[model samples]
Target: MSQTETNRRLITELQSRGLRLLDESAGAPSRRGGAGPSDHKAVQINGQTVMVPVHSRSAAVSPFEAGASGANGAVQLTRDGAHVGDIRFPEAPRFYGLQTLDGVPYWKIAQLHGTDVLATTVLQTCVRYGRRDTSCQFCAIGESLAAGRTINRKLPEHLAEVARAAVRMDGVRHMVMTTGTPNFTDRGAALLCESAFAVRAAVDIPIQAQCEPPDDPVWFDRLKAAGVDSLGMHLEAVTPEVRARIMPGKAEADVEQYMAAFADAVAVFGRGQVSTYILAGLGDSASAILETSERLIALGVYPFVVPFVPVGGTPLAEHPPPDAAFMRSILQPLGRMLAEAGLRARDIKAGCGRCGACSSLSTYED
Candidate 1:
């Protein structure tokens, strides 16, 4: 195929498999994506949900074919967006080179997100992860735990050790530390703060931390004071029914708790710094997700919408991802709302939004 033909085929193939460019412009919310209420192609390949172009039917091709990327589609060409060259992976920085005298792999502890940001989940196991009624259906938090890939929790000092190495050794510019829920009064937020403060003392990299909204909104201020520059309070689903079904334990907090937490986070982290994830295809409608997003934007919080990609071996294992067209439909209206609020994903200082990986919301915003 000609290079242009090869590129077009590559885009079609990737879209057929639910992948798209991460940065916005051509396949934007209002453009060719499903956000328009127009029919977009969908298929089940090997039982996984995929969003195909309306005219094509196939699985994904290698990302190397076009200027597209593997993680987020940052370089996919769309008609309206800026024609920036493809965004490429940041090289493994020097910090990934060093290890403590103990010989624990530094990259294994925490790794860079996207190009330059360091991200780690210090505590990777959730209390009710495997239990039938307590786990978040969408989370694979304990998948690595089951395979002995990570410890249930890492000590503040251990986390600090890796954080320092990542900064001084790697060209890492920002940091994000997250944890599974701990059965403590601090709800694991306190431990994240301790680690953040330690990393701050060692390097000048800004940090972002995520956790379940603590029992008290006051903890948001505590995290900010402890050198955490941004916050991610994830509400994976929008409606209460979906939340309860997908994340029974998290749903226990109630929507009111989440709203209150968002208000508190905005107060401490400022507008555009606070973020929440709202997964698509989880039994909620496009209107429902966008309506919630609109309300969130009004309160200076970002609705980081993502397509529900069913990770292997979770309770939702048998479940399928939402078709890509549905994700496009939801993102279009919501992206507009976010744009009007001036809540560009890049404006998020740290975490998933800034990395622009894990979801296509950033592309929609484009």
Candidate 2:
């Protein structure tokens, strides 16, 4: 295989099967139980930072394992006991040590994703998360909060303070502010707008705000006016049956609602700035995912398809992530479709799709 193809396959395999570290200290702190990057760790392979499953059940028995770290901090990786190559873990962000004036730790308010992308959950509490029947089976959004690792609600001022420090001390390039769905008609858009406005005022970093589609389309303009450069309204599953079965509460929004919202968001954020996350391992088939990606691309929305690695405490904790073959079937074609549509992750200003760390689809775009 060519070098590019090798990297693509390697990344896909690592994400699907996960990587087990012989010594936990060799890897950076693995994020466990949170709104984003849950049960995973950021690993830099071939100079590309990707989030791989390191705490999932699959990882415990994964064929790939990281051995001892070299003098230069590079760790040797072995697949099924045979050495594959060396990989490095990102140093913990320097801003993590700072605290707000009110005595809250900065790390609890916002966390770093990938190498330089700073991310935070504006509102950790969600209306649907309180009930098992209404919750997304794959979600562990409440885990971090219950463990006292994060505050239920992050004040806008605290967010601004932490964001500024992250940019100044760690050289963070962009910020992603996502919120749990709130009960109001505006959903979490209102909170996101308030939070994004504060962060933008404190620092000039680009921001991506994520929330469920609001009841009214006018909120798109409101979000743009608040200095949000990108928007993400995720559609975790494409097929209605799968959505309803997997996430009964979120499925209530329906595909039609998401489609309309995507159009409105694209108009405000521009073509490539509007994006949605589509987890591939859920019940949706590869064909179903590709169909959704095609329609999303036509609507000027970037569909970020990533493997669904189960979180430790979620209902689907034991559920197996999509195998490498299954993921490649969806991502390879989806990457071509994105390139043909003139949509690329590198062009995105800020967001999960732009970070492209949780998925290898970005590699296939070439």
Candidate 3:
């Protein structure tokens, strides 16, 4: 197979089946702190960075596993003991070991996503998490806070300190700051604006700020003025029924509100700079996802369609991940749609879509 085809196939497999570590002593840098599926490990295969679930039940029985024996810091990827390819585990970032003046670990404030983009949830507490009927079934935003792996709320000053360290020590090119919705009309936009300002003041890096649509559309301009290069308003499920079933409270910000918000955000951040995350497996059919992608693309919103990984400790922990075939069916056409519309991830200034590590859509953006 061609290298590109091989990579596409491998990414589909890894994201769907996860990866098993045959040797725990292989010295791979496992995830130590973060929200949602804290057991993932970053691995590079065929020049693409992917987060593979290593501690999930599916991974324990996954056909794919990494063998310890290798050269040049590379390991062998195998399926049922048959060689597939060579994979390399990324080393932990230097910033992970550093601490703030108050003695808080830098890693607890922000963690590396994909290869070099630093990511953090600014507000760990969510208004919806208090009630099972309202919480997003796939969310584990509070898991890290509960485990004491991260602070409940990251102060702007501390975030600035960490951003400076991460950029200086690890060559982090960009940053993604997402926040759990607080019980404010601004829906965490105000805090994101403050945090974005601090990070930009400390480093020259581009940043993406994610939150639900605020009560006021003017916050989009405020975020842009605060040095936020991109904006993300995630609609994890495209259909209202699926959304209501999967993320009850979040679904209250109906499709119409999100559409309005996306329009407002795009006006400030510009077309490709605004994006939304669409998780493809919570019972949204490929047709529904594609139709929604069309609408988002029309509004200049880059649809970052990703496979649903059942996060541990969440209500959906036992829910199976989308099948590899199912994901490819969605991504292949969705990638083509993005390419034709000139809404490629590379065109995104900075954000999850631009990072494009969690999904294999970028590979199919031919």
Candidate 4:
């Protein structure tokens, strides 16, 4: 196979099958405190950073696992004991050890994501998380907070302090500040604007802020004026049936509302700068995903298609991730659609889709 094809297949397999760490690699940094699966470990394979599940069910008997023996700090990746490739683990960031003047660890404020981006949940608590019917079934947003790995709410100044330190100590390229929905007319836009403003004053890094569509479209302009370079209003699942089933409370916002918000957001943030995340395995058909992608691209919103990974503690913990073939079916054409529309992730100013490590769509972009 060609190099691009090889990479695309390898990434899909790794994400689908997960991987097992050997005894020699016991000390590799593993994700413990954050949203989504806390069981993931970031590994660099084929010169790309990909987060793989190492502590989930799929990992226990994954066909691909790191070999016990290797030399020169390189580990051999094998599928059923046959050599597949080589992979390396990324070390923990230098900023993790540092603390603010008040003694809170810098990592608690923001953690390194992909290779060079810093990401954090500005408000760790979600209003819907209190009730089972209203919560996003796959969300683990509060798990990190309950474990004391993150603070419940990050003060704007603390976020600014952490952003400055991350850039200076580890060369963080950009920052992603996402929040659980707070009870306000602005729907968390107010806090994100305040936080982004503080960070911009402290550092020169680009920032992407994510939240639901606010009650008023004018919040988009306010967000732009606050130094947010990009905006993300994640749809997660496109079809109303899947959306209601997966994220009941969130789905109440309705796709029409999201579309309206995307239009206004694109006006403020520009075409490729506004994006939405669409999880491919959430019961949305491939055709459904492509249909939504076409509409989103038409509105100047980049559709970030990612494979669904089940977080361990959520209601859907036993739910399986989308098969690799299923993901390929959506991403391949979606990549072409994005290319045709001139909406490549590289054009995005900052955020998860730009990081593109958790998903392999970027590898397929032409």
Candidate 5:
């Protein structure tokens, strides 16, 4: 295979099966349980940093394992006991060591994602998270909060402080501010606005704010005015049946509602600036995912389709991740669709898709 295809295949398999670290010291500090990309550590392979699951059940028995660290922390990757290639872990960000004047640690407010993107959940508690019946089966939004690794609510100013420090100390390129849906008509848009406004005022960092579609479409304009460079309204599942089965409460908004919101959002954020998260293995057929992605691309929405990683401590913790073949079936075609529509993830100002670390879809976008 060509180099790009080789890297794409390797990343897809690693994300699906997870990576087992044979030498504990070989890897950098990984995100344990948090809002985005939990149970993963950022691994740079062939100059691309992608989040690889290292703490999931599948990881413990993964055929792909990393051996002892070499110079500059590069480790040998072996698949089925055969050496594959070398990968390196991103070192912990310097901002992780600082704290707010009130004694809140900076790391809790915003943690490093992949190599340089700073990420955090502005509101750690979700209205639906407390109940299994209402929550997304794959979510672990409350795990970090319950474990005391992060606070319940990150005040706007506090988030700003950390964002500024992260930029200055670690050269953080962009910021991702997601929220647990709040119990309001605006969902969590108001909180994200406040947080994004503060961060923008504090620094010149590009920001992407993610939340459920607000009750009013005007909030999209408000979000753009607040310095949110990009917008994400995630449709974790596409079809009605899968939406209700996987994320019952969020499904109430429905795919139709999200489509309307995406149109409104695209008007404000421009093409490729508005995006959505699509989990590929959540009972949605590969054709269903590609069909949805085609619609999204037509509407200027980037469908960031990622293989679902079953995070520990959630309802789907033991659920099997989508195998590499299934993911390849979805991503390979979706990447072409994205290219045809001129909706490249790299063109996205900021967000999960722009980061392109959670999934190997970006690798196939060429």
Candidate 6:
């Protein structure tokens, strides 16, 4: 097959496989059944168990290195024309072996993203984490809590110590800090600013923070002034119907509110420096996602679209991912728009938009 034909085929299979994976993970009380304890990160996809990353803040263990068996899983992967492993295991972060003066665990506060980026949720609990009906169905922020893997809130000192350790010890090149929604008026953005400033006091690594829009748009300036280099405000699913069903509590805040937030954020962060995650496979139409992408690009915002990776214990684990054809259909065209808008990912200072490795949108953008 020609190169284009090969990529097209690969994209299709990835979507189908991702969708099939989600379906098997949902409906069960947990993604793993009859599998006993199972190391907390083993998940089954259509009876074929696979090891997936489990986020934690207190311990320094590679959930990937401890993954359960999946010899039956597919392994043919296409990356830069080389067929490689379907999912390579992420190495343990180099900083995991350290701790703070108070004996606080370094690995417990921050974890590695991809290979070089250190990422963490500044606060582990969300106002909605306690409410099932209003919860963002796919989120597992509370899962680690039940497992005793993190504290309810991460102190600024904890973030600072861990941030410095990740960069100094692990050679981390970038950092990202996010937080759960607070009942407070600023939607958790201000807390992110606080965390960023704390980290900035010790290190010079580029940092990105994600949060919902604040009632006061000026907090965007505060976040930037505090040394946050980029921003992410995820619009997980675009259409109102899917959002209402998938992220009920967050959906209560409408797209217009998010758009206004993005607009103000772009003014401070500038062009590609601001981003929003548009997750695929939550049952939104491909056209709707592309429509949202076009709108975001017009506003000079990078719409970083990623295929939804269902958490094993989440409510929608059984929901299938959108097929590969669906992903490319939206991404290829949208990638063109990103190029036309001169909103390239390379321009983003930090976070997922710059990483572009998690989603195949970067593939299409190529």
Q: TM-scores for all candidates?
A: 0.76, 0.99, 0.97, 0.96, 0.98, 0.80
List, in order, the clash count of every candidate structure: 11, 0, 0, 0, 0, 5
Residue pairs clashing, model 3: none
Q: What is the C-alpha lDDT of each candidate?
A: 0.64, 0.93, 0.86, 0.86, 0.91, 0.68
Per-residue error for 226 in candidate 3, Å, reads: 0.6
Candidates 3 and 6, the one with greater TM-score: 3
Q: Looking at candidate 6, what is the lDDT of residue 258? A: 86
Q: How would you order the candidates by TM-score, starting with the best? A: 2, 5, 3, 4, 6, 1
TM-score, prediction 5: 0.98
For candidate 1, write residues 279-337 as lDDT tens digits.
77789989888888888888898887765655555666446556656766776677677
**lDDT of each residue in 1-366, candidate 4, tens digit only:** 898799889998888878888853443367763663367878788788877878767778799888654566567899999998888776678989899999999888888887789988889888898898999998888888888888988999999998998899889999999998887478899999999999999999999999999999999999999999999999999999999999999999889889999999998899899999888787999999999999999999999888887777789878888888998998899999989888999989899888988888898786
| Model 5 poorest ten-residue lDDT run | 22-31
Q: Per-residue lDDT of 251-291 in model 3, one digit per residue for the tens? A: 98899889988998888889889998898789999999999
Candidate 6 lDDT (Cα, 0 to 1): 0.68
Q: Candidate 5's residue-wise lDDT over 1-366, tens digit each?
A: 798889899999999999998776554578778789999989999899999999999999999999888877789999999999999988788888889999999888888998879998999989998898999899998898889889989999999999888889989999999999997599999999889999999999999999999999999989988999999999999999999999988899889989999999999999999999999888999999999889999999999999999998998999899999999999999988888888898998898999999999988889
- In candidate 3, position 15 carries an lDDT of 84
The residue ranges of model 2 lying beyond 4 angstroms of the native Cα positions read none
lDDT tens digits, residue span 282-350, model 2: 889999999989999999999999999999888999899999999999999999999999999999999
- Roughly what TM-score does model 2 have, to 2 decimal places? 0.99
Q: What is the lDDT of candidate 5?
A: 0.91
